[model samples]
Every structure is written in structure tokens, then in C-alpha cells.
Target: MENENLLKQISFIKEIDKIKYIQRRTKLFNSDRNENDAEHSWHLAMMAIVLAEHANEPVDVLKVLKMVLIHDIVEIDAGDTFIYDTAKDHSNTDEELIAAKRIFGMLPKEQAEEFIAIWEEFEEGKTNEAKFARSMDRFEPLLQNTSNKGGTWAELNVDYQRVYDKKKVINEGSTSIWNYSENLLNECVDKGILKK
Candidate 1:
């Protein structure tokens, strides 16, 4: 029964093997292309580690990494909502919330509650851990856009301002990363990889 709880927890550890990134055909951080969700999660976790010290306050890097790794598991059901998709007609939040409930509920009562709390915490960005996790979350997409030559941004025809507007929540937690992200986005605009 003890192990069953762990097993149940893994039920949400979606293979995502068949699921490709929205920019699956695009490059990764170092210009190596064809990244998948697993690769993306791994990369984001690594990014969180590298940038953890830049957080506004002391943060639990391991917790933030866990948050990053699991944050998109709901996408297993709701599918990825391209960050620029502002259609009130298509709210992935409801579907994601439902999926979160179903997926997190699979674990043992205590474990499920614990992980659900962390997941909810990350969603709310109320704690330092959640804030730092979200900081990495917002930064990863920016890195991908700039690194992969503006794949998602180009696909969505999003402007630089639109990117900033979408990611401004990071400012509430890590002003340093937020400022750096803004500067990087500006550099990307100057290079013309992203639109004005």
C-alpha cells in the first residue's frame, strides 16, 4: 500500500513521448533543435538551478525544480496553450484545473494532498519557492524564443511588448530575472529575431 501511493503519484508523470512541443521543429537553448517536453522540463529544471541565486529571496531550489517539472503535467490533458493565445473563448484553466484534480488525486491521501498543495502554491506564486519557480517558468519561454530563433513568437506573430506583457508576473517575484529577461527580449528585438 505504501508503494501503491508512489505508483499512483507517477500516474501523472506523463510519458509525453508522443506529445511534441509546439515548436517541436525548432532549436533548443544552444541552437540544437528538435526538443521534446521531457527535454524542455529537464532544461527548465537546469535553468532553475543556474538562476536560483538570482531570486529575490532565499528559495528552495529543489522545490522550485519539482514545481517546474510537474507544472506542465496538466498539459497532458488540457494541451499547451501557446502563451500568446488570449482567446477568452478558449480557457485552458478549467481543463487544467480538472486535470490537476484527477491527476493529483491518484496518489495516496497524504502524498496527494502534499503535492497538490505545492502545485497550488506554484500556481498562486505566494511563497518564495513558488515565486522562484515561476520566475524560471517565464524565463524559459523567452530563452526558447531567442535561442530557437523566435519559433513560438514567430508562429504567433507576437510583438516584443506582447511578450513583456505576458511575462510581467515575474517582476513580482524576481525583479532581477525580470529585468534581465526584458533586456534579453530587447536584444532579441534589436537582432530582429523577435518582432517589435
Candidate 2:
């Protein structure tokens, strides 16, 4: 029955303990250390809360948190993609769409749809909520790189321009936050925290 399938899905949580999960081969932050998707999602949700004031327009932080927490569940099915991989030509959106149907479809009807909608909103990045949520999403890794001595950047041979290219999403959704981020990155550059 449809109801039966939904119930089963709700109870099935993908395991996040596997070391291979969310192990982005980044040269921007720490060396030989990889971040898990669950941790990244949780951290981004928290960053959304702490940095809500920097949004270009006021937004519902709770909604953003929900979006962040659930956004990458599909990654469990489709796998995480590295940011700088030239071969990763297909957008994560395509993979996640299939993943969403399978993952959220497991939950009960109403809840599944609600969660799927949130995930889709995040993928589209069209709404104020999605935009606000995404700014936090993009900012966290930059912070990780700068605070951790830009080990990731150093390994990747990253330049300031590459950093800006990767972080443009922050500016698109929230100029205030973007300004703050720019200032931070600039400081990091000045202090030799991020490679120029």
C-alpha cells in the first residue's frame, strides 16, 4: 500500500558514519581531513541562524534551517559532488531530483511532499528563503579554509579569484552577507590566511 511504503521510508535513515561520505577532496581548508554531509548540513543550518541578520532581506531562519538540514538528503542517494571537479559537468540538481523521489517517497505522503518541496526550493535557489539558506551554505567552506590556514586552498593552488568564483552565490542572495564575506576573505588574504 502507498501508506505502508511511506511509513517504511520515514524510518529508514541513511547512515552517515561511513568515512567515504561527504569527503570532498578540497585543498581549501584542512589537509587529509574531509567533512561529512550531515555535519556540513548541521553547520550550515547553525550558520543560517547566527548570520540571519546579514540577509539582504529578512527571512524565516527556521525555514532556512529546515531547508539546509534536508537539502542534502538526496546526496545520500546521488552522492556528493566536488565543487572544483571539471568532470562533474552535470549539475547536482539532476541527480538530486531522482534522489528526492526515492528518498522522500519513502516517508508518509504528506511529510514526504513537504520535505521534497523544501529540497526543491533549495535546489532552485529562487525564493528568498532558498537564497538566504544558500548564502550560509556557500559561506561555511570559505570560513573553514580561512580559519584553518587555507590548507585546502594551498593544496588546490587556489587563488583569490577562485574563491570569489565559488562564493558568488552569497552575494546573489544577500549583498549584506556578501559584503561581510568579502571583507572577511580580504582580511584573510591580507593576513595570508587564504592564498592570493
Candidate 3:
């Protein structure tokens, strides 16, 4: 049973490597190459750890890290939904839930349950850790876009109202970070990188 569990765990790890190929709409800072799900997840995990102190309410950094790292594994099968893509419909959560079950189920039962629970917690955005994790997920792409001189926002002509609508959740996690982001957004408009 131990060996069986080990094999399942190994298989799950191998399967998640596919996340590296799941490209997102955001580009790397000063680079043309689009970021992938794996890169995004890793970035958010690091942000969760580094920015935990800024969270409005205390959070379990480890839980936030776990939430960010595992939240997008579903994207491996469900495909990435661009936040600003008005043309393409947002990802169907039903499909993503199925993908999560199939992918995380590759692990042993207890481990699979824990991963799914973390993913759901992040999705629900109810707990302090989940809220903070969600903030990191949203904030990272904003930074990427700002760094790339409006990156996808410019290419798509995304406006201030739309950007604000997408990012308001950042305030739930860290008011300091949210304030910084708001300033950056205003700067983007002033610089003509994002539309007013």
C-alpha cells in the first residue's frame, strides 16, 4: 500500500509538469515570451510568502503558498482563461472542477483530498489565507502588465474601469499593496499605456 501510494504521488507530480506548457496571456517583464501556468503559480507562491506581512488580517503563509501553487494545476486540463479577454468566454468552472478532480485524484486519497480542499478554499476566497492568495494571483499579472509597458492591456485596449473592476479584490488581502496597485494603474493611464 505504501509503494502504491508512492507511485500515485510520483505520477501526480509528473502529470503536473504539464502546467509549464499552459501559457497565459501575460508576458514576462521586458520579454516577449508569454508566462506559463507553472511560472505564474511559482511567482504567486513567492509573493504570498514575501507579502504576507502586508495582509490586512493575519494569514497562514504556508496555506497561502499552498493555495497559490495548487490553484492553477486545474489549468493544465481546463486551459487558461485570460482575465481581460472579452472575446473569449471565461473558463467554465464546471470544467475546471472536473479537471481538478482528475488531476489531483492521481495522488493518494488523503493527499488528493487536501489538495482539492486547498484549491476550493482558494476558489471560495473566504478565509484570510484564501483571500490573500487570491490577491497575489490577481496582483502578479498586473505587475507583469505594468512592467511590460501595459503588455496585454495595451494590446487589448483595456481601460481603467475594466482594470479596476478586475483588481478590486486586491484590497481584501492587503490595503498597502492595493494602494500601490491603484497608484500604478493611475500611472499607466497618465503614461498612456492604459486608456483612461
Which residue runs of candidate 3 sit more than 4 Å off their true CA positions?
Answer: 87-92
Off by over 4 Å in 1: 3-27, 30-34, 88-92
Q: On residues 1-196, what C-alpha lDDT tens digit does candidate 3 reach at each position?
A: 9999999999998999999999998998888899999888989988888899999999989889899889889988888988887776663489889998999999999999999898989898889998899899889989999999999988888889999998999999999999999999999999989998
The lDDT per prediction is 0.74, 0.76, 0.90
| Candidate 2 CA-lDDT value | 0.76
Q: After superposition, how far is residue 14 of candidate 2 from its true place, in Å?
A: 5.6
lDDT of 1 by residue, 3-54 (tens): 8766765764544343444334335765656566667777779988888778
In model 1, the Cα lDDT at residue 63 comes to: 89
Task: Tell me the tens digit of each residue's lDDT in model 2 across 1-196.
Answer: 8878755764655342332365554433454567777778778888888878878788988889999888777777777776765578534567778988877777777877898898888878888899988888788887787767775676677788888888888986789778878998888889886777
What TM-scores do the predictions have? 0.83, 0.83, 0.96
Q: Would you list the rank order by TM-score, best first?
A: 3, 2, 1
For model 2 the local lDDT of residue 56 reads 79
Best by lDDT: 3
